[model samples]
Every structure is written in C-alpha cells, then in structure tokens.
Target: MADTILVLAWLVLAHLAADFILQSASIAAAKSGHGSRALAGLFAHGWIVAAVVVPVGFAFGERGWWFVLLTGLSHIAIDRAKVVLTRRAAAAALREAHDRHEAPRPPEHLGRAWTPQPAALFLADQGAHLAAASGGWAVLLAGVPLDPGWTAAIDGWLGSWDRVAVHGVASAAVVLIGLAIVNIRAASLFVGILVRPVEVTAGGEHRWGGRVAPAPDPDIRSSTSAAQAPVGRRWSIRLGPLDARVIAEPEPAIASPASPSTPPLGGSARVGSTIGVLERILIVVFVLTGTDVAIGFVVAAKTLARFRLLDDRDFAEYYLLGTLASVAIAIVSALIGRAALGALLA
Candidate 1:
C-alpha cells in the first residue's frame, strides 16, 4: 500500500511538472494554432511528458516503460481533442451571434469574460490529463510489486536509513511539490478566469473606458434605467457551455482628454503574475508551518504596496478578488499537504 501511494504521488508530480512548469509558453500557444507548427509543439510537449515520468518508469521496471509510452500518447491525444473542440466551440458561438444579427466579437475581444469557454476548456483538458494519469496507474501499476533491484539500490544508498522512512520522506516531498505547483500556476489560471470582466455596450453606443466594480449590483436596472434597457447590444458571460449571466449595457464613462500613452501591458502583467506566484508560495509556507497569523502580515505588505492603486474601484475589486482566491488556494493546498504528510509519516 505504501509503495502504491508513493508511486501514484510521483506520477501526479511528474504530470503536473511537465504540463505546467516545463511546457514553454510558445509551445502551448503553438499547440493551439494551425499547421505543422501545432503538430510539432504537441509532439514536443508529449516528449516532455514522457521524459519527466521516465524515472518512475525506470524504477518500476519493464512494465513502467510501457506505462510511460501509453501516458505520453494519451496526453497528446487529449490535448489534440481539446484544441479541436475549442475551435469548433468558438466557431459555433460566432455562428450563433451572426444568426441573431449581432456583431460577433472574437473570444479575445471579450477580455476574459466570466467563465469563458477557453478557460472551461483549459480546466477540462487538465482534468482529462489527470484522469488519464490516475487511471493508467490503477490499470498498469497497482498491485504490482516495486522493482526489487531499485529498492535494494535505494536502501544501499541510504545506508542505515530504513527503507520505509525513505519512502515516507519521498512521499511527503512529492506531495509538497505537487501542492506548490498547483497553488502557484494552476491557481493563477483559475483566479484569472474567475475575475474576468465582460464588456457591455448598449444602444449603439460603444463607450469603452473606465473600470466598473466586478460585483454586479442587483439594483443596477433600477439605478440606470437608460443603460440597463433590454434594447441594444449585449453579451453573455458563459459558465462552461451555458450562459450564466446576461449583463445589460452600462452607463457611459465621462469623456476626458486622452491620457498619455502608457507602457505596454505585457510587462506589467508578467510582473503582477510573478508577484502573485511568490505570494501564494509564502502563504503556503505559512500555513504548513502553523504560522497562520503571519499570513496577515504578508497580505498587508502586498496591499500597502498597491494602496494608491486600490483607490480605483475597478483595480480594487480585481485586486481583492485575486488576492482572496490566491489565499484560498494556498490554504487548501497546504491543508491537503499537511494531511498527506501526516498519513505518510504516521
């Protein structure tokens, strides 16, 4: 049972590391595009998936190699399916909009509308890959004894350390690493989707400036009758395949002189993402160490740095939503890790 748990943990760790950490942004983008480049990127990512799992396979013996081969192929197949499905879904959405005589905006133009199809598809894709990993392990490796030679080598290397102790340590490490990966990378993707803003235009007015509070007001219709009228252009915020919310057009922003050109957003976005990653990591550490009270200091420091920006209602909402989500993910991951470590060591 211990061996099975350890091997499964390693399998999950490898999958997460390959899919999230090692896969380059360019490769991920290319995989979602057309032509031979897409195929090349897909294959490259598949190779990485296999490579990361090779150590586990090698340790497990000959059957492990076969497991590695099947996992790699399955990953490529799953990703290809996601790409095709996403394209078809996008096309169908555009067709539906055209049939209604509405001007169709591209998905990107939606500016991360709440629960967008792409984000749903991304979550589904990852879920499929993880399912494959767990299912493959159950089918191929469960109940099979660990390779004796591998165990003997590890024992020899550790000298006086008991094999069980080593396995416990290894399992703990794998669990912690997996939690860190999910808290940092996976949570970022999730929080971004959750905080996505849907743009609403009405009555042929295309005013597109100013940030609105993320939370929709229940009394918005009464408060802004002209803007909230049913007549005019509107878009649906999707929850998976369904339209979760249909926001009415909003009041126009007061026109002012065009502000000076700002720097490209790409750099700032990258910096913010990096900060978020660090913040989550620190939060996880605090939780695991039973220093939960220290988490307040971390949040305060982050908020203080962005205190001036928080004056903007839009920025404040975005910042608050993202911070809460990050903290939640970190806490949950840490708790899971703590439980797993306790089980392993006990």
Candidate 2:
C-alpha cells in the first residue's frame, strides 16, 4: 500500500516537472500553433513520462515495460487532446470574430472581458493529465509485477525519519519543498500570462495588459481607428473570449499638472508577486497544521482588502481567479506532502 501511494506521488511529480518545469517557452509557443512543433512537444512529454515510469517500475516491481507503455501512450493522448482542443477553440473564435467585426457593438463591454478560455484550457489540460495519471495508479494498485530490489532505492529516496532529524534533510521532504517553490514560481507565470489581457494597440497588434506597445506609424490609419469612436482617440483595448471584439476604454485624463496620474495598467508587479508568494505559503502552512479554517480567514482578508474595488468587474474577476488558483495550488501541495510524510513516518 505504501508503495502504491509512492507510485501515485511519482506520477504527479513527473507530471508537474514535465509539464511546467521542463517545457520551454519556445515549445509552448510552438504548441499553440498546432503545427509540427506541437507534435514535437507532445512527443517530448511522452518521453519524459517513459523515463520516469521505467525506473519506478523497476523499483515498484513491475515486470516488463507495460507500465511504461501504458503510461506513455495515455500521456501522449491527453497532451494531443490538449493541443488540438485549444487550437480548435482559438480558430473557431477567430472565425466568429471575423463575422462580427463589422457589427455595431458597445465599447468597454465589462461582461465580455471575463470570458474564461485561456485559463479554462489550461486547467482542463492539467486535469486531463491528472486523470490519466490516476489510471496508471489504478493499474499499479492491481499488482502487475514487482522487483523487491527496488525497495532499497525507494527507501533511500524517502529517507528514514530518525535520520532526517539528525541530518536535517530527507529526500521526500526536499521534493515537497521543491514542489511548493515551483508551484509559486513557474505556475504563477503561467497563470499571469494566461489571464493577462491582450490589448489591441493603435496598430491593431496585440500587447499584453496596456497601451505600452510601440506607436504605429502615425501617418498610417489602422482599421481599428473607426472602432475607437466610443472611447475617444486615447484608449486601450481589452480582448474578450475567442473571436470576441476588443473592449476599448478611455484612459483617465490627468486631473492636474501637479497630481500624479494612475496608469490604466493598474497594480504594482513587485507587490503583487510578493503577495502571491505569501499567500501560497500561508495556505500550505494552514493545511499541514490542520487549521484549515484559517484558510477562510485568509480568503476573507483578501476579499476585504479588495472589497472597495469590486465595482470594476474585469479587475474583480482577475483578482478572484488569481486568488482561487493560489489557494488551489497550495491545497494540492499540502495534501500530497501530508500523505507522503505520513507514509514515510509510518
């Protein structure tokens, strides 16, 4: 049973390591295009799964390469599905937007900005990978083949409880720590990029979150110029769901020469990053200590902090999504760590 649990952990660890840590920006960009590069990245993920499962199979006493084969094949299928579905959805959105481009629509449609595609696709991709992993776990639990020799290696990796006290370290302990760090560091980047609004700039090109893109040729008229009627000439584009028109809103005019004006972008990057790390830490600590109710206090505190700003539905949704994502990541890490620690202690 302990071995079974370990196998499950290994699958999850491998999934995280491969999907987030190992995947490069170039690969992710390529995967978005649904081209040969997408296939290549998908294949790369399969190899990663195979490498992890093979050695674990040896230790977990699984005979032959059935585990590897089963896991790798399933992982490939899931990844391919993720790639295809995301691409298709995006393409369909483009087509729809083209049809609606000429239609009269209001500027700054608050409700449209909150449509969750990029975020949803991301979550769905991860969920499918996890489900595939569960299938592999089920197979292992059924008792395929085991090499008892693998126990020594497994034991070494987990480390003994007393030895950990003296040495101030344990393999499983370190793995958990790394997992928490990676979740905050890398996963945040993914979420940030996904949720970040793509603003249609003056040149009709998209920029992330603001009107900071290089000014297009001042003499050249963009097709979007006509669409700027609602928000004056100075405005920013906030993109909506797949194929949805960009929402333009007027940038606030400066009140006075002496008064500092707020940039439409809003929020301090450094401060937000700091808050994210702190929240993840708080969630993990609260979960492991068995004071889960404290998690609610944390949530309430965050809500109260932002309650004054809820009038802006777009910003509110962004805050809400980010908060939920942070809490979810912490909860998952804490639960996995707790389980692994228990088995190691037992």
Candidate 3:
C-alpha cells in the first residue's frame, strides 16, 4: 500500500513537472484548439510526460511501465479531446457573434459582442488532468503489484524510514516551489492571452488587440503616433503644438461613479495580474490546511462585492466565470502540493 501511494505520488509530481514546468507558452497557446499547432503541442507534452515518467519509474521496477503508459496515453487523450472541444466552442462563439450582426466591426460600432471563454476551458483542462492522475493511482492500487522487497531497499538506501521521508519531503518541496513560481506566472499569461478580447473582421479574419492602453512614457506628443491622441485624459497623449497649454477635467459639483461604458477602472493590467497571484496563493493556503470550503467564501465575497453588476447578465457571467477559473487553477495547484506532500510522508 505504501509503495502504491509512493509511486502514484511521484507520478503526480512528474505530471506537474511536465505539464506546468516544461511546457512553454507557445505550446500552451497553440494547444488550446484543434489544429496542426495544437496537435504538435499535445504530442510534445505527452512525450515530456513520458520522459519524466521514465526516470522516476526506475524506482518501481516492472510496475513502472504500466504506470507510465497509463498516465502518458491518458494525458494525450485528455489534451486532444480538450483541444478539439475548446476550438469547436470558440468557433461556435465567434459564429454566434457574427450571426448577431449583419456586419461585424468593433464592439462599439456593431451590436454583436462575443469573446472566447479561454479562461474556463483552460481551467477545465487542468482539472481533467488532475482527475486523470487520480484515476491512474486507483488503477495501480487495484491491479499493479508492488515489489515485495522494495521497502527493504528503500530503508537500506535512506538509512531509515524517517530519513527517507526527510529526503522525500525536501525533493517534493523543491518541485512544489518550482510549481508555484513557474506555473502561476505561465498560467496567468496563458489565460490572459486566451481571454483577451478579439475582434473578428467582417471578412472572417480574426484579429488580436483591443483599445491600446496609455503608454508609460509620459511624453506622448513626441511621437508621430501622438497626433491621434486627445489632450486632457490620462489615455490621451499631448496632441497639441509645442507651446499649447494642457487642461485637466474640471472637478464636478457632484462626483459621479465610473460608468460601465467608461474605460477600464484600473490604469493597467498590473492590478488584475497581481490579484491573480494573490488568489492562487490563498488557494494554496486553503488546500494545504484542508480548508477547501473557505474557497466558497472567497467566491461569494467577490460576487457580493460586485452585486451592482449583477443586473448586467453578460458582465455577471464573465465575472463569475473568471472567478471560477481562478478557483480551479488554485485547486489543481493545491492537489499537486498534496501529492508531493504525500510522497514525502507516505
């Protein structure tokens, strides 16, 4: 039983190492949908998972082969299914958006509005992977045989069970740290790209980018591009001549709240990205302490805090979905942590 748990735990660690640590941004983005690019990403990821399994499995003898094949093939199958499904869903969404308006253009000009739910799909993909790992563990427990003398070797190799655990814990901690540092940043960027608002031209071509944010360089009037900017607002560059004076918005008699139609409330994506980092950290805390239910409170608080936007069904769904995505990512990360911890203590 201990060997079963040990092998399974290490497999989870390997999965995280491969999926989150080794996979690159280009692969992640390309693999979100079914295409040649997506196939390439899936194959590359499957191979990486198998490669990680090869060295780790050496500790398990013949059973290692069964574990490797099961987990690696399952990884490929899950990812391939996800790519096909996600791409289909995204295309359907784009089609629905197109159908809404006879002529598609900017969201401001066209009556149609549609954006891919990359955030949700990405979260679902991760949750599926974790679930698959769990399934593989169950398979090992039910069928695969552990080496009868493995415990003797483990004890002899490490000097004692306590020492074995200590070494395991240290190794696991290194992997977990790599997970936290690499996965969070990479996941954030991947989801950011996936969910970025895309504009589809009437000609059936998809285009990236949206309202460009105010550049950090304050000297906006210096560039040839500054001619298109307006004078007063933060988003506006100094468009006037060299001697022209600048004026700010006059203080109103009564301060009004920012409207839904107004520009993004925060100045830049920095605030949103920071919030994501914090969300994942809290999730790690909750998972490690076995306080998963508190995650519900986090979600509830966000929903209530944005109660004003509840009337806008579209906006509400977007906010709720994004929150759920964050929760899902955290849950996966926490599960990986638990697996690593188990390897250490088992």
Give the number of the best model, judged by TM-score: 1
User: What would the per-residue lDDT of candidate 3 be over residues 197-256, giving only the tens digit for each residue?
Assistant: 333332222322222111112232122123222345433345565344446864332111
Tell me how many clashing residue pairs each candidate has: 0, 4, 0
CA lDDT, candidate 3, residue 17: 77
lDDT of candidate 3? 0.56
**Would you give me the overall lDDT of model 1?**
0.67
Per-residue lDDT of model 2, residues 234-277, tens digit only: 43445675343445566643221111243333346446656777
Candidate scoring better on lDDT of 2 and 3: 2
Off by over 4 Å in 2: 60-64, 92-114, 148-175, 178-182, 185-190, 197-267, 300-308, 332-340, 343-346
TM-score of 1: 0.67
What's the true lDDT of residue 5 in model 1? Answer: 62
Clashes of 3: 0
The TM-score values for the models, in the order shown, are 0.67, 0.64, 0.57
Per-residue lDDT of model 1, residues 101-182, tens digit only:
4432222223312335645676798889989988988888877777888777877889997877777778878998899889
Off by over 4 Å in 1: 88-115, 160-165, 189-267, 293-297, 304-313
Candidate 3 TM-score to native: 0.57
